[model samples]
Target chain A: MNMKLETIETDVLVIGAGPAGSTAAKHAAMGGAEVLLVDKKSEIGTPKRCAEGVSKNGLEKLGIKPSHRWIAAEMDRVRLVSPSGIDVWLNQENVHLPETGYNLERKVFDKHMAMDAARAGSQIMVKTLAKELTLKDDYVLVKAESMGNHIEIKSKIVIGADGPESRVGRWAGLKSTSKPKNMESGVQFEMVGVELEDTRAVEFYFGSVAPGGYAWIFPKGDDIANVGLGIINSMTSKNAYHHLLDFVRECKATQKAVSVEFNVGGIPVGGPLNEFVTDNVMLVGDAAGQVNPLTGGGIISGMQAGLIAGEVAANAINEGNCSLENLKEYETRWVEENSLSFQKYLKAKEYLLSLSNEELDSIARAFQGSDFERIGPMELLGKLVKVSPKAMVKLGKIF
Target chain B: MIISEFCMYCGECAGVCPRNLIEVGENTLKFGQKPCKNCQICIQVCPVSALEVEG
Candidate 1:
């Protein structure tokens, strides 16, 4: 009887405070809807669990202005090192498109993003954990605990941006049905003192060293970098952390680097989930598994989807119908813009994992001789067709 | 019943294991000695073909 309980109401309740959640919260509030964003952590983005690489164009796609403060390194080229260490440097010069992006210090980036949401008229709460969800007349009720007190929040709509381990989506019956193959087990180390040959080119080493995955050296600065790898295929029994350590030991370029910080996390290596929205709810970011299958990068796609989700959720609130019928627009629109590319990445992943070490070396050779550029999944198919029309034909049918 | 090199350690199998018998070890996955009831849930959840079904 002595326990205190508090209650509040808002038009939208956004969960999680990563880039996706904060972006959604900002957009929803910008649309004149009362928004509340919550994160269980005391801080928004600490204990980073990412490789921290985002494409330059991807930021533009999400409409996020490049902030110099959090942008630790600006990549100029990406080198794909083959099994034989044949480096295929991909840049605007050869790839016909810019693949360069920033290596972010996510801790600072996420805090400022959520603060922006606050400035846009949304209330933000940290260290608040949503415990349960109940659907009631015209709204959803969220039961949460914060600072040793129980709180009840009512909202017309809920957006789950709660990362890979999102409970809100599960509470809304959108349980993750992803298979292990559709997820990437990733580990990274923030290292310094590596004599990086190309400070501007992020290096990806591919071979038996990282079976079923590729190890990367994303330079954070001239002598410091984030070295990580994601694995879902191959024949290794070692965990990804040990695999990364082993990779560092073996790579001539990474040997001298000393680890200063370590991070581990899982990535949804699948396309968007089968169901992203149901009655009165939508999911964004890793919660909806909106990451590239091949690259294991979600920040770009997650932020992009957040923009659409926030707009759709806000529109539904304005339209006086927060039902699944109205909210399903988020799903349709996101899929329209992103689904094909996601599916193609999945296909490309299958093709990449199927190739042997010798084939990878050959791929390096093929890229060297090619004049074609902009090697997205579709472009990858065109390149594959030149050598293996049969494989391309099979992949074409699926994609 | 061994985890091969292909695992990225997503730990989906551990999460889905009904008996909660899976443990994450350094660089590898370990299963408990409890006799599996043949639910096949772990097999169903594994994304890659890393699980060995038999000797």
Candidate 2:
């Protein structure tokens, strides 16, 4: 690692090099802004925090084509497991869903995305941690440390693409705190000896295994999978790791599985922040709480917001105005694009959190042997309402 | 706040801190100079229960 003291200036500065930051940097550079993107980690992505599942449609939306280099597995089926071990399966032919796509090798995928940003003329820096932000009238001064070397970056706009533990939002004085109930504590293990009922399917287990959230087995190969779970800490004293261990121990499919890697992180399940822009600073991705409240999935959404923020920042810089009023466009556009679905998901999440183990099993029972190919979402909900009216009361109104 | 050796520097604590008083490096977790209100939100969110109140 080269530790060099430096001072640089750019039209846009992006913090974090995850999916959101990389996409923001790529799009901003493509928009003709002189962009600089930085990540605190020595590598762009490692110790993977996600289940690495993404849809073909999500990549299509971002104009990204699937490459075998970063694709671990192609999935056509999604299995939802009940507390009592009943499984309800859905496939692409049965229902159009975003989750029926492919499992990604995020380590390779993230770096490739960053490489796209570099190809678009964005300067990239790894092992660079942004320490402080100084707000100025026209530009923000960023004090960063790169491998023990102090560096300064002055930019017309700063995009906060940092992950869940985002400091950028806080530094900019945004109301960025997620309530304990709204945050999901997640733990995952890359297990090599896992047995899968369907090698091409991704499985989700719901009930006591994970309170508020659910457990998942995202297969990376025929025999290896990223088995994980996320649970709301406020709902239980057991913590996420224990819940994951319990799930693994209890599941028949993972009896022979041994963990080769352990990963842990937090997911913000709150809807997007009320505001993600302040003067020249705009927040994207998890920093802006742009994750799906129900699924705890943010990669696609984050990248979408990143593209928007990149373009908006570039336009604001081109117009020589990086004011709060100018950056407000980003928030407005993002909300317009996501608010409806996000709100619905938030309500569904609340409903899901209220379910008991029995309620979960009953709901799964309702779907057992049902022809998924002919069942619409409304029919599914109707079944849910029949099986668990008490829990469905809240969910009914959301639909 | 005390971060135990069990900590993996995953930043779950920092994200849940209402005061934004924790910073996570690659292999480090440090409380900011600002006084922690002892909200204990960090402790609750820790996956391995790695964070605790200072004695």
Give all candidates' CA lDDT scores.
0.77, 0.88
Mark the regions of model 2 whose C-alpha exceeds 4 Å error after superposition: A1-5
Cα-based TM-score, every candidate: 0.84, 0.97
- Fnat, model 1, is 0.03
lDDT of 1 by residue, A155-180 (tens): 99999887765556766777655556
User: C-alpha displacement of A388 in model 1, angstroms?
Assistant: 5.4
Q: What is the lDDT, from 0 to 100, of the residue A378 in candidate 1?
A: 78
Clashing pairs in 2: none
Q: Give per-model CA RMSD.
A: 5.7, 2.0
lDDT of 2 at A21: 94
lDDT of 1 at A192: 90
Candidate 2 chain A least-lDDT 10 residues = A390-399
Model 2: per-residue Cα lDDT at residue A197: 93
Candidate 1, which CAPRI tier?
incorrect
Worst 10 residues of 1 chain A by lDDT: A91-100
